[model samples]
Target: MGFAVAIVMCALLIASTTESQHNEAILRARIVTLTAENQRNGVALHARLAACEGGPADLARSRAASALLTPEQRAQHLAANGPQGFDVCARMESADRAVLETLK
Candidate 1:
């Protein structure tokens, strides 16, 4: 039963990650249309790719981005990572919770 719960957590993580990926791709594409800077582009892309660990990835991505960016680039990346990212991430989290509840 313990192993079963681990498997379920992994599955839910992957599923929610996929859904969030879809939204991130759409949001990134939309934002890119407004302005295109490959530094922030890479930041956004890398963050989405590393979105598996939830908040930790967000922190790591931000730190990694800071290492590779100027202050202005960091500002753009931070500003860009607002409403769209949160909306989808929150949805993913909600979906994951729903799956766990259903499992119970």
Candidate 2:
């Protein structure tokens, strides 16, 4: 009887651990999705704001802000929206890299 109870307890522990891990993975995936969605929304909002201003200065400001994104992010943005969309990000990367080199 004791051995049977021990086996049952062990099985329950394993099942609970598996469930916890699954839950954690689901939450992690959700966080990643939400973060990406928010980043995309911010980028879109910047473009909209620039359009609303209807001037070169606003467009330039929007381009400068795009440079703040990481290279990977720039690549992803370009891939999704095409080369024209990320022109400013790509253009600024070299200058940013040069400054970083000077700082180093």
Task: Compose the digit string of candidate 2's lDDT tens values, residues 1-104.
Answer: 99999999999999999999999999999999989987996687455333332246455763676668764554555556543424555455566568769978
Give lDDT tens digits, candidate 1, residues 2-71.
9999999999999999999999999999888756665675676456434522355467656775677764
lDDT of each: 0.64, 0.64
Give the C-alpha miss distance for residue 1 in model 2, angstroms.
Answer: 2.3
Alpha-carbon runs more than 4 Å astray in model 1: 36-104
Q: Which candidate is the best by TM-score?
A: 2
In model 1, which residue pairs have backbone atoms overlapping below 3 Å? none
Off by over 4 Å in 2: 54-104
**Model 2: colliding residue pairs:** none
Residue-pair clashes per prediction, in order, are 0, 0
